[model samples]
Target chain A: MNGNGKKKRIGVFVCHCGVNIAGVVDVERVAKALEGYSGVSFSTHYIYMCSEPGQNMILETIREEKLDSIIVAACSPTLHEKTFQSVIELAGLNPYQVEIANIREQDSWVHSDKEKATLKAIKIVKSMVEKVLQNESLEPIRVGVTRRALVIGAGISGIQSALDIADHGYEVLLVEKNPSIGGHMIQLSETFPTLDCSQCIMTPKMVEASRHPNIRILTYHEVESISGYVGNFKVKIRKKPRFVDPDKCTMCADCEDVCPQIVSDEFNMGLSFRKAIYLPFPQAVPGTYTLDIENCLGLLPIRCGKCKEVCEPDAINYDDQETVFEEEVGAVVVSTGYDLYDLNHLGEFGGEKYEDVINGLEFERILSASGPTGGEVRRPSDGKVPKNVVFIQCCGSRDPENHNPYCSKICCMYTSKHAMLYKHHVPDGNATVFYIDVRTGGKNFEEFYQRTIDEDQVLYVRGKVSKVYKEGDKIIVWGVDTLTGRKIEMEADLVVLAMSMVQTDGVNELLKKLRISSDANGWLSEAHPKLRPVESLNAGFYLAGCAHGPKDIPETVSQASAAVAKVGDLFAQEQLLHEPTVVPVDEDLCSGCGICVTICPYSARELDKEKGVVKVNEVLCEGCGACAAACPSGAAQQRNQTDDQIFSMVRAILRG
Target chain B: MRIRNREKPFGIEKPVTARGQIVIIEDRCKGCGFCIEYCPNDVLRLSDKYNSKGYHPPYVAHEEECVDCGFCQMNCPDFAIFSVEVESGEREPAPAESVKR
Candidate 1:
């Protein structure tokens, strides 16, 4: 309320988050130094500014002193920026007038010397104080939402989110690149710990997703591009050529029975074969077959309409081209999931050269009820039950040099599951496992590992397998016995390498388009490691399952539900608030150079030919500052952090 | 010096019972002091004097009465130390009567 024009009174509060700051610096000394700074109506120090007492003190001070502007020095703004902003707002202060100085992470946590840390904290406070003195009142920008969500990838995580969102009475568009929605889960035979059948638990969810009234399952499609921010995104989907009419197709297998070509079946982990036009599995969500255009006989147009003549429904349409459709969605959940690490990278293990060696996923399929040999534990090379089976743990995981340096977190349990399955299938067969460490820390997970050892009589060796080579029909494994200080060797009929889990290839591109950051391991970076594990740096975008990191079934499903809760909260609002400090274009300095257009990750900019100017779409801009830095003419300026503001701040820092 | 002789076996000469002197090369030592720390006789010590690299290398300050023990050479990380057990009777040839007897 600026009814009467007067100088605005501001208060600055600096906090030492316990020893997180005060252990290395003198907090009271720094606060005393800034007591008489200009425009600082009040200055104080607190132990923990984010606690209940600390927040109440701030609100009380703001009300009692009638302070206009607020400045805080605490931990990283990522931790408690919103808490203080809300506290000040409750005290009748504008939220936009708050500025934070990150003294804990930037100053105290990294420095050892007390004097240097204290001096750094003072400088940071001074800079933030300068910025707050020049601050002006701003209004929050509101955009209407479409109240619809788009879920990418039809894996278990995506399916769970779609189901949960649709159950909440909202529309969901679930898109999958494959013809079916089961993803890698459908390929697995059994889950770990409980030894439950994978299909027994997964097929029901697939059927529910297909029949849900609020869900639209779009298979054989991909998201081509995304524009606008959360609550107002315009998404374009590219539907690849299926050559079959989905609306008219019935649950008939005539087309697959008459197809002339056969290809390797990916659903079986490439252990079996499938026709050119066939369903991924009998339990595919859509319960229909998809024609592989690359290998379909009709695509060649030589002489293959045998299925059309025999079909009563006439669902085959050979002339259907690719179609592109656009939809407006309010929020997006990225659950693209993960891919298995390739073991061929470790050439010393004779990975690809040995026919008897396979990955854990392939072994899972072999143990599945609907597997190639009808759940028979047989060696692929000779078609005989293996006398001895050896499972090698940590093939690509935890090796800093050539593979992922993080523990996969699922291999230990899955390997134990594999041993139990082997014992169940072949009673006389011997099972052995070589591992560096067994990390079975989940609920009843240690008991599961113990059951395999004590009840099933599976041998556990404590060491890493150094070398593996093929010797005729057997694979010779060489390793060291660290407990006994002896080198040991064993010959086995089959070996399974427990591979690691890694992010999909297109994740980086998707993250860039969505304006989210990822950690060093390529997992989408969470807001905080412990506090907010399900949310990303970008609002309205939540992470689920292996897209964030490797996790087993229980952990993955819990996180998926957590993501659903977040999206539901976002959809409950009538309008969404976007940061007002986005980049803006200056029409007077028009040069339509188009450099900034190409640099924007969100495609939020366009050049207007009629006026010879660059225009920015306010809804699409995410304020990443990439385009502003690329603007050579200095025509593009970001709100609140304009070029003038940043330049002045830097100059004042250098002056000190 | 006193000496005791024993009967020889085949072409071997008579055995003599005499304490041996110990010598240490300071340049090759790494200051691990396995000998000084584990010596049964407490005869060896690490010298205060340092070498080119300024490390306090071990030395045998009293070499005359050493009962040669070879424990230092076994535990050095760099394999830089070794012991030479020289017979005390080598300085002067055994008396002719003792050798013949």
Candidate 2:
């Protein structure tokens, strides 16, 4: 737009999108209508505005007609906003000077009436035309970045992220809540389809990560709090006391012999017991005994000094206390992984009451050679080999309103593996699986499931189990075969429930602390589901693994690597350029109400108590317009998003 | 559906013959009966009194028989009960027993 009351020189370019739009909307009529519109100097229609010739057409029109700004009526801006912006920027026009009127997704693709679609397309163009008249040139704000990265949760995803980022020459702090870095992957005996030993594949990575010069592995620790934005996050990690010093204590059995307290071995999924003073597992990362303070008679010397007195290295110190430390990082990758839905909630399955009924992970432990039963397929009720094992699929998944609505992506394959493993352990025995459907989407997964039924003799019943109960030494399962339309009942020695997956516990609180958005299903929400899957809606933070949704091992590793690539890209840049559309408070208009300071999710705004006004951290502000809407005095106005421009556009649309 | 009969996982035996004082934290009890079922001297039983969460917590039934094995304390899933050893002369009598004496 020009000054001194002269009409602005503007141009409009309408696209056919290869009949994706022209099939419904009359592109010729819409272009002709906008050509005659006020302030439009030139207007034309193109077969493909994003194509080479079509882009050249817009560039030629801008120079030939001496146009000030332009509008491209095409598909949704999310698809090609940057493409057209860079094109116009090359033609000596401000990137923000151009507006993309989404006639396809908003008009042509939605409306059926040709006459009405053309009319609506013209109106959409007119609104952008009016909005663009007041557009101002803006430059991206450049900010400094810290070189280090922080990875929360040392699961396979976190481990992979740490390894990838560290390999790329960036320092990483890998934090885990448990004393080990393996996560649930470590507890697993074998993986699906391939049947490769999980420990053999997992431990090498763990050892490599612990030894990585760029990676600092922090096990037995948790993120207490995290502040600051991406490129400079100040993290507070809480380190739980491991009473037994990891360095001095040579993992000997002396303390275990003297310790009298017996506690459930949680690492084995509570299937067996261990001494109060014992290692989490034989191959624990640090390989040190941690005194169970809750189960220990007391933490004082006066109470029970058995372990301390017997300790040859004198590593058992009762004075150990939790310590919180801080670190600085440029980016964060949250791959905390998922937790299995508890089987105890399903009363019909008798999962909690009946000792024979166990969960999938527990069965995994039983099949593991280092497990309590020494890898033998023995039922917990009685240490005997279970001849006929019953595996239930979709136990608490894919049943909306009653249980989890989403399918646990790994269950179908894992159940097939369980049955196959069972048949392998007991050559003479057979395994039966009750399922709604056998989903084998991964590579060789379908063949594996078929092999289980054909070679392994695992029976697959297309059904959902209604109830299960223990009678004598057998677990009776009542179900119906949907394919045969017949009700059936059977008795087996043990029953395994394939429970659903959920975002790990305390993740919601952690998301709130990080100011990261989560989906309705409570999984971490990504910036864009299809395009920006690895990035969080908030800047400098990324999502990976089952943190966003249920995913198998391969998918989790892929996502973790993708997140690492994103962090690497950010680190590759010596400085970052942030969006300059942030709102700045007009000190004269701001009453220092402090609403913007409290309402900002990113904590980008701060109230200046001395000046009785608020200030904005432009680098942190994402221009979400929260404070702009809340401003009573018309302060905190976003650049280029002033009230006058919006009124003009709304008025243009309302003008019949 | 209830099973016909049930049995405890295993029986515990006291290795020492020392007098002990039993301490019970009322609210922490979940009434799993791990302490009662595993107590070597049969020193505990489920009480008629219920905790705030509606589980019938166990109470010391035969305190004099406790031999400071700490089996009940170790077996307690909730850590609601424990026994501390006492010398013959160090034992403190209960209020009712002291009144009777």
Candidate 3:
């Protein structure tokens, strides 16, 4: 290897990309313009350098001309940087010797004037040529992968991701903050459009995840902290105490029946009662009961062991303590899902003040077959069937001044589903929906909404509900009729608010721990909006479900599978090869000052106590150069841009 | 104020009188052009002259053509315009004195 050589022969290849570049900028002219540049041994143009035929031309030229370095002027390097890097490597050249200049996205697409676009392409090509001349041959850095994955939150999205990843022959650690695996899906009576029972479809998947050999399901747990980079992450999970031995428990209801302490059942949206030792739902995965220690008689000062006395298996234990375990994983997939908007914030609707008002999730519980009233269309207050029910759409969505400005995307369909469900249950019941607009653009979604209105005879009112007030036995709904141009009022026994979806709590702390990016709305950001929707800027980490954005069941499941595919591709290789363009710390010049350590988003740098200097972890360094710029002593130098390289590049541009 | 005499030789409907002033505050207008777009009577127009922010503000080009419908004020996001209706054939001083008493 000529570590610091002077006599270098460079080859330049310009791609037309099928009129993507050549339609406006003349590719042949660019090659000709750069023909006589210093040390340029060969110059050529191809219709598409990324295609098979074009790659062959580049490989052949490198061999024939004995090109020491190469440059490709084409689309943004983000699109085909890896493709060209591999092409040069196959030709027996260092992959780091290749540099790409963007001309399509930055030039032709943005500029209408052909002459200006051509000139801009020429300048970009010239800068890349200058940089390639001084390029040093370098070796790719290799890091060992742990080959295990972590799935956060045991919701439907997390369950799907864990199962898919486990089926790919990799170990997965599935962590959940609740006592059991079926999340919000288990609370719903039925799904939309198809009217399929929610538990009928969700229970099987939960059981499979629990029984999968490669998956270790950890319920009633949360990740406390995460350290190290991808391929070597040490995660600490905190398991809360359930006061019950999970392994020893049998599918017996004797313990729950004897527990006299009763609390509001969250599974029924707090509209029903539950024992201290009770399952979240009758169909909960693993089918075990959790002893709520907070409310349990044994944990309280009163000391009651009624549940233990009744259990034949002696599964109830009051002495259990919280446990912490650490696991190492190569990749992590965050699928924390979403929480429904709180209706109490809308004071105009008499939200929590009225007993008849409830949010969508709570309404789902009331409609469930196992709910308090056994799936009867009765009011929660008096247990009497109501003559009329009113559903409010966009209660906390699409209101820029007081609520979320963005459309929740699922409200319109779910509200229509709720109305249709009510009409099906009570034949003579009157159902009315107050909405600003109806968006049903999915497959067979529009037909479902139409059938609800035309066949089911649910009233569709076009306007916003101004206020809701309690009137002794019934809630009064006041709204303007945009169609009739008059104020209308209705007395309904029940009101359902279609709430918005928001990010799960403590997401910011997780983002900081993982060094991942989030958009303005706090959903995880992807590498590219259209191309790499499942991948993040950091390698070995992927996103899925509502953590990425507001998506329905079909879209969320598809994206979860996509993330599994990406992780599988990464684990296929024994060792991961990283770009040599990472930042390096000069041991001689570094002073134990840890300025770069704090500014590094990835925590790639640390002060070595033995050496009394900063040490850079190559695996964690993404080469963003943020730490390098923060270095006060100028000791942290990013590869490919050593001080000498940047100085020379600046001089070349200024001279030209 | 003199009302139309019923016994006149040539009897005709008395001309309708005007009302209180309908004021338009120019500075608060955002020039969204909603007033001109929604006006049914075609009494409002976006002025060619620019405001302090260099946007064409809405102006009542035909002041006498206003119908006092209040449609323009309701549609305006910035609340730049409003209308008032007073009884015909009443002097401004007389009406002010009756309200004060």
Cα RMSD of all models vs. native, in order, equals 27.2, 8.1, 22.9
| lDDT of candidate 1 at residue A231, scale 0 to 100 | 82
* TM-score attained by model 1: 0.77
Recovered fraction of real interface contacts per model = 0.00, 0.00, 0.00
TM-score per candidate: 0.77, 0.83, 0.80
> How far out, in Å, is residue A119 in model 3?
7.8
Q: Estimate, for each residue in A1-656, the C-alpha lDDT of model 1 and write its tens digit.
A: 22245665777788888888999978997788677776678889999888999999999999898898788888888778889889988998878788888988899999999998898888888777677666667777788877889998888999999999999999999999989998788878888777778899999999999999999999999998777777888899999887677777785877765553444466766555555677888888676778777655334313345456666788877777898999999888888888887667778788567766888887887788787667888776666788899999998999998888999999999999999999999999999999989999899999999999999999999888889998777789998877777898999999988988888877778778777898788888888899888888777688888889998888888988899898988989988887777788998875889888999877779988888889998767888898888898888888767677677667656654
Please state the error at residue A40 of candidate 1 in Å.
5.3
Which lDDT tens digits does candidate 2 get at residues A1-656?
54346567889999999988999999999899998687888888989999999999888888889987899999998899899988888899988888899999999889899999998898999999988887777898887899999999888999999999999999999998887788888889889889998888998998999889999988888898888877878899999988888888899978876554444567777666555677888888867788877666565423556688889999989899999999999999998998888776798997578877888888888899878788888887777899888999997789887988888889999999999999999999879999998889999999999999999999999998899987777788999999999998998898988888888889889889888989877899999889899999888899888889999899999999999999988999988888788999999899999998988867899999899999899988988889998888888888878777788888988883
CA displacement after TM-score superposition, residue A73 of candidate 1 (Å): 5.8
Docking class of 1: incorrect
> Which sections of candidate 2 miss by over 4 Å?
A1-9, A16-41, A106-130, A300-302, A651-656, B1-101
Poorest lDDT segment (10 consecutive residues) of candidate 3 chain A? A295-304
Cα lDDT tens digits for candidate 3, A179-200? 8887777778888778889888
Off by over 4 Å in 3: A1-6, A14-37, A44-57, A102-130, A251-260, A297-302, A309-312, B1-101
lDDT of 1 by residue, B9-47 (tens): 110112122344555566677677766765434457788
Clashing pairs in 3: none
Q: Where in model 1 is the C-alpha error above 4 Å?
A: A1-6, A12-67, A70-84, A100-130, A505-512, A589-604, A620-635, A642-656, B1-101
CA lDDT, candidate 3, residue B93: 16
